[model samples]
Target: THARAHLPAAGAAAMDVAESPDLQAQLAAAVHALNHASHPSARLAANQWLLGLQRSPHAWALAVSLLASADHPSPSADLLFFAAQMLRRKIQSPDYSLPDNAAQLLDALLVAARRFCLAPPRLLTQICLALAALALRAEGGVDGLFARMPHLPDPALLELLTVLPEEVAQDESGDTGVDSATRCRFARELLMHAPAVLEFLLAQSEKPAAADGVPLHERNHRILRCLLSWVRAGCFSGAPASALAAHPLLTFAFNSLQAFFSFEVAIEVMTELVSQYQELPQAFLSKMPYIREVLLLPALANRSEKIIAGLTSLMCEVGQAAPGLVAEGSNEALSLSDALLRCVAFSSEDWEIAESTLQFWCSLAHCILGIDEQTSKRNATQELFLPVFSSLLDALLFRAQIIDIDEHCTGRVSSIPDGLVQFRLNLEELLVDICLLLGAPAYINKVCLFC
Candidate 1:
């Protein structure tokens, strides 16, 4: 093929396979040897050969051909995955380029991603990643690159959107070879695209079910996951709290929690938003009443351990994010605190869910006892929390009573389980904080009872 003749030689001594078939055969043999070779030296040689192949200009075209090939029988999954991976690397390489062939490369990636959208998600992910890298590296950014990609199926498009923010986040963190200036520019472009992306997600989520029969819950879960990736990437930074609060995506996330399939991701989305309270106080504040009424409070009463654990962590997130709220003794704060108290004191041998509240308790103790100029305010704060601290101390003491376990069950006869030891250490730190607040002698007497 004329394409092989035009392939830029990798180096002075790099071997050149003369045709597509020859190159494909060489890559397959190398992959097999690297995976299945019995001898160390043969495997090492294959690894070296494949690494050398990646550096060749031919690798760019070869990867695309392997990914998009339909003329021959379908390639092995390993070869296809390698091809997708290679395409991503080539796009990411600062020194790698096909100045005039970028459009062709982008089209080829979309084709490959579309072909493999149903299964073996890893290959599809790599193809999407390659497209994302190209978008960052291309001239007009996401809009331009995606503008060229007008006909992708919904699943492929969603997958691409899902990976775009993740790729941008990964790149902005300095893992990619692209220079800081380029990554910064790309990130700004992505943030610029956030509104449109959110709109896209809302539109997709509102469709009762996809034309292709993707379940409503699954679609919403993916949409929420994409929103989370963007939020973590700082795409929503400086957006108005009111605007974010009113966004359909936020509403959709809240709504998703009612459905079992989407509940876990929905909790994560809510937790992330709650965590951003310091940055978007009004946004999270506006939702706090709803969160307490519809989500946290109700979830706390449920008997499912998973629900209890998730909502407990979320409640703690709110408490830690706004220790002052806990100090102020708002009805909302009091209610969430009551929920946390139940978590700590809930009857269970495993302290894992209870342990989630330790940091919040420690933060509250700090708030109650930290140096304050207003003696009256300090007293009021201490007065409000003293009983809560005392109750918590009692729960900790009750929880600390040692219990015998079958030696074989833990696989250690002498040493305490690491989990138990860590739980006790954390409890000790919180106990000291409680001791300062409730009076040392009272704390000592409480421990004496446990002793």
Candidate 2:
């Protein structure tokens, strides 16, 4: 009569009296009080009760029962999310040990997760975190967990893989109650599986969206996020920079930028790709056309400010990633520097997009200054970058000038916006770098002329 069917033997030891018939009634009441209670105090009491249950010896059984109850008509999303969350918390608790019933628990979780494949993503995310935590703490590690993941419905499975790397990396910070030794072991295990993860992601990317009833763009977005997560976890760190540059996932992410729906995530993926793998000459070379295409978007003038800002930010990363290329004045470099200069020339009110390019300019300035006067490339690089920085200096000065509002009110200069003031400070730092490239005395003479 006990709700002990899904409870592992290890977790069952202390559940005899805790699994009474009244347990279900108590749980239902507490859930209702937490969700629909009229009074704040009632909800608080219910929350405290649930927290106590999370730490109870019978918590595993209770959560399993709640998750398995999805077969009943109209199961509560709150219940499913709460159960999944509780499992994750328990697994990450310092006092927790690997339950003898872990495999059984995994099976139960997989089943429960599949039942709610189309559930709210928060619930799916929690379930995935729980599975990830379980995988990290148990015997077989991520390889075994990944081997069993195919049984999940497509969305559920993707969500699981997506969260696995992120959770493992987060646990390495020691916030998950996993000791450093175990964390290091799990990290090693995760690295061994990285290749498999890459292959799996590539395969998933090739699958049509219709196969899983999820939209193609949505599926690809998830794949992009998974790629980003893996990159952040250093899964690809061991790969040669050229191989990473040519990776199919990175190519897919680049292609994703062409779409309206996937544009934001695609920018993020590309930005991370270039920023982290700056040494990828092959990758940057291959991506030149795409980079050029983004800057020349015919409808760019019609796009929203946020989209333009995102594009500008991505270009800034591109500029910093290959400052050498920019100094070499390759057509690609010139095109990129042109785009950045245009961003700097944006209306004074739109200072943020302008502000974003300051670092890129400063970087170009340093790249130019670092050139040896004895080298033949030195003068050529200065000639290439001179106009670019000069145009930027002019733009910064224009941005700094306070509006007089009217010639009649010339002495009463309008108050400079705080954003512009901060932007000017940033401009000063870049000005120093620029002055280093073009003699400081020349810069002072130019300023004196403006005065």
Candidate 3:
């Protein structure tokens, strides 16, 4: 009867095995081969066989066996990750129903998750994502899933985040932690746990440790990555998200942007915040004073070229978003426009950097000159707009076709004259548009300069 109970559904059309005993034996063999196969090729074949059973009702049965194998004293990140993924996918199917042993199944996963913190980043990320699939499942069924026996989501999930694989801290140094979209997707899943996860972050930020010798700033940096993930994914809603906004102790996120040699992470966090401020302009622009403070940090003067370019472009975006913030005398005294002009003036030799810097200048120039505004001209002054127009004129100088190398070249070519012409066209158009905004006199000067 045990064999009969495991048979394919009676209504399973053409593929219903006429015999239940044969199918059950195959299932047993597949599980055994996967567990004891001595050779790598044999193991690969067994893994494939189990994967193939994914279309059958018994796929959940196969998943349980595979997940069990993941616990061997010497574990395989590959096997453990794939098995968890398979189980997660199995539970996701609309036709698949949870078995009587649902609690037991989740308990196994919880045990695996507890130990995955020591795994490599790729494997660790995958497992956390898999558990996330379970905790935040089937939409409206979340409450039911949450009520099941086991630990609170806060501690369980916080442990996963606390050990954050070290790679994420290197974000500003050119390390890509994970695909941004994937990170955001999992982040949303984590946020579905809400106030619990937020509580964990709040607790850490309150009394952080030099645990394992990790610096306090670096720890907050990783925590902010988790926090910002929700922001980027637009999951910054609900009580927990509101609590984060109101947390006085975590004010460092916005304030860290000015720290000397020690705050690259904070600079990056606030930069992202400013860059993504278009989401809630009112909320973000209100912090313009602090944003301006970040823009004027003296440390930027001595930083590397990459830092110079990133911060310069970011500050420029801040100016574009809140032009009034940079319009001289409008803010009463200091304005971000001075810092923006400095960024453009120093980076004039690098076209990419110069272009980004100038683009911001052009935005403000258009604002001041009333090029596209349907209403009356802004109350902008010559002193306010002088740096903008001057910087654009400097950009125009880069477009001058010095020699037209395509004409004299007899051998291999470098950026054919057509390519160079197109390149110059953008700068020429930028200068022309700016001059046009500044009116006829500036336009005539531009044409004469090109000549």
Predictions in order: lDDT: 0.75, 0.75, 0.52
Evaluate model 2: give its TM-score: 0.87
Regions of model 2 farther than 4 Å from truth: 1-21, 171-176, 294-299, 348-350, 374-376, 401-416, 440-451
Give all TM-scores, in the order shown.
Answer: 0.83, 0.87, 0.62
Give a tens-digit lDDT track for model 3, residues 271-319: 5555654432234444544554655444355544555566666666666
Task: Determine the C-alpha RMSD for candidate 2 after optimal superposition of all C-alphas.
Answer: 4.7
lDDT of 2 by residue, 1-451 (tens): 1122232453544454334558866877888899999999999999999998876768887777777773556447776677788888887676656467788878878887898788888998888888888887788867778777767887888888788777656644656466667767877777787888788889889996667888888888888888887777778786787677778888888777777788888888778777777676435544555655654354256645666777788888877887777788877777777776766766645479888888888887888888898887898888777777777777777776765355576777666678878877878788898887767876776667656
* Stretches of candidate 3 exceeding 4 Å from the true structure: 1-50, 53-72, 91-104, 139-141, 144-196, 210-218, 233-250, 255-303, 328-335, 345-352, 357-359, 371-382, 399-413, 416-433, 443-451
Error of 3 at 60 (Å): 3.8
If both were scored by lDDT, which would come out higher, candidate 2 or candidate 3? 2
Off by over 4 Å in 1: 1-19, 29-48, 94-100, 171-176, 277-305, 346-352, 371-377, 407-413
Q: Model 3 shows how many backbone clashes?
A: 0
**Model 3 lowest lDDT segment of ten:** 1-10
